[model samples]
Target: MMVAASEILKPTGQKPAALTIDGLSLEFPTYAGAIKALDDVTIEIGASEIVGLVGESGCGKSVTTMAATRLLPEGRYRVTAGSIRLFGRDPFAMDETELQDVRGKLVSTIFQEPMSALNPTIRIGRQLVGVIQRHEAVSEAEAERTARGILKDMLIAEPERIMRAYPFELSGGMRQRVLIAMAFSCNPGLIIADEPTTALDVTVQAVILRLILDRAKRTGTSVVFISHNIAVVSQLCDRLYVMYAGRIVESGPTRAVLEAPQHPYTQALLRCLPERVEPKAELEAIPGTVPNLLDPPPGCFYRPRCPEANDQCFAKPPSMAPAPDHIVACWRRETIQPSIKASEATQ
Candidate 1:
């Protein structure tokens, strides 16, 4: 039987959070204007816990992952507020050398496009060896041996052949496996997977998801999974954070939030899922586009599209409310339950 993320055992006397982003706000400067990409985003991932960041496209899910990994470009993007800590170390404050040390060894990322992340010119084995060698004071031969071992552990058939092959020679699923192998090469404490299964087919996606969950469980590694697919998040994550227009709209234990979503945006997203529709029934879509971050409207970022929006929603932004283990930033959460009930009844 596979262990759930919450079932993983933690080391004694360790801090509760392996990763924490407190009041994080980021902006990008373009000729158009400065676009606020993240606003007061606060989230935490405990040791061995899998936390999901879910939103529609352009909702800052990728930005949050980049910020946590310290991979955001320096001049193009700026952090106007908030702090991010990984394993109690401040990645933003670290010098280049120090940051380099922390990146692959302490933290690793599995990007959506494996072709872009992997070097096409280099042999897969050589790249994996380089990663291991960079983080450890080991001989080239030793690094190669370790690389092969990691690939084998990922359940790749003919691990030696895979190491010798270039990334272009591998299938999409195979290439993704290599990326997962590299991310786990150094036994990183925190792994950021930014839609790692997006390009895969359904069957392959299931395999990749299982590989990730299994590895994290075996190693007790914390994961920050970013996805636009709520189904994927619901399957893998212990907790969920819903983002819209750079702001977190709702967050709580995944089951709690999914079963009884408190914010209008979150509730609408769940209702839009394919499973919620009867056969031959038309799909539901959340009306309106995401707000323009450069010139976002006053008050709630989601107000313009919210079904339950009122005068108070246009007058001021809603603060997070104390709702047991859940947090919601909506003025009409109290009335949302009835709306959900009515929507369900219609279906």
Candidate 2:
């Protein structure tokens, strides 16, 4: 369907596109010129699927989210071209009233820091009750009760007491639990969890992850879990999409991608996982830093750091053609030596 289309600075629609992004592009105008935050990006999340958005910092991950949600400040960034559709309808073209109806009720976000996401001065119960009533039409007392119930599911020892306390009174993990509670309260079609566990201890991180995965399963909620950690994604996501310099370099089923990485960037990511590999073992890092978004490499963004880069790699953007179910944007997919053969070749 040709959904409503909005102007560069406008926002549009409510229903989720099953959610598809077609030829998406976003840029920021600076004194120098335009910094390309996203370039010809395309992705789709099926209903109830947990798809991951994986990348190192500055790969345009967060920028992609901000643009998708129309959360960007006016005039600060620009959507030069493309569509952000939910349910095949244009979110950009939706009017302000429609946008408000869609954003939190149909789509919600869990930020990297809970403290930043929550109001420090307000009590947790008030915040939770307000969100529930805003979208759900529940009475304040009923919403407050629902909030306590969700907090209990997070395994909080005293959900009632915790709800009454301010965000500052709660621990970091406690605050995160409350965030998850709020997100679930709406039962949104899609939930964007951006680095959701970055602020807590390792033990608490595991607990929060389990709670997220468990609750998501029961709700059958489609999620876009953004993270720099591969191990965490492996545990939660059904599929993985790896980004590099504002484009997706690799995407596939989680287990297959983890076991047999086809792109050099994907390989480097797995090789750098400290938890899965030995502590004393030498880690593999892509040699160069990510290229400047303002003037990204002419061809492949990862060409400078790819060990197997060839003359052809510098001449054109690699195609993300299908290789089984996985789509890879590397010229060396066929050339990647099998792990077993590589070991023998080394010997």
TM-score per model over all chains: 0.92, 0.90
The residue-by-residue lDDT of candidate 2 on 215-240, one tens digit each, is: 88898777889999887898899888
lDDT minimum window of 10 residues, candidate 1: 1-10
Query: In order, what lDDT does every prediction score?
Result: 0.86, 0.79
Task: Give one clash count per candidate, in the order shown.
Answer: 0, 11
Angstrom error of the Cα, residue 320, model 1: value is 1.4
TM-score leader: 1
